[model samples]
Target: MNADRAETVAILALGWLASNDELGPVFLGSTGASAEDMRRGATDPAFLASVLEFLTMDDAWVTAFCDATGVGYDEPLRARYTLPGAEQVHWT
Candidate 1:
């Protein structure tokens, strides 16, 4: 996934999160992000990637996000690879 695509997915996921009565507050509290921050972050690729990364942390969240956004379950994996500093660390 390219940065643009990943950012789009993240934005969509953020919208879903924000609309959920339970998860909305949890997401904001966990990330310490205000509504203002989310508005600002929507335009920031790195911030968007972080939002996706946060959602990918849990399988239930990933499933719910995917179902809500009409994306495949594997999208989060692809999005993670597109983010900055996502290079594999080969320690052999």
Candidate 2:
């Protein structure tokens, strides 16, 4: 995905997380982000990447998110790779 499309997916993921009663608080707790932080972070590529990162942690979460958003299950990970802070580390 291109950066623009990746960002759009990340924003969708954020909305999904925000509306999930069960997982919304978990996300906030996991990321240490307050509501205000979320509002501020919406435009940050790194933060959006984190949202995708969090979303892809569980197969069920990814499945549910994809189902809800009508996107492919792999799209989140793909989008993550296209976003900032997602560069692969080369240790060779």
lDDT tens digits, residue span 1-92, model 1: 77778777878887888788988788799889998888888888777777887888899999988988798899886887787656789999
Which parts of model 1 have CA positions greater than 4 angstroms off? Answer: 89-92
Q: Estimate each model's TM-score.
A: 0.87, 0.95
lDDT, candidate 2, 1-92, per-residue tens: 89998999999999999999999999999999998887877899999999999999999999999999998888999999999998879999
Q: Indicate which candidate wins on lDDT.
A: 2
Which of the numbered candidates is closest to the native, going by highest TM-score? 2
Angstrom error of the Cα, residue 66, model 2: value is: 0.8
CA error at residue 61 for candidate 1, angstroms: 0.7
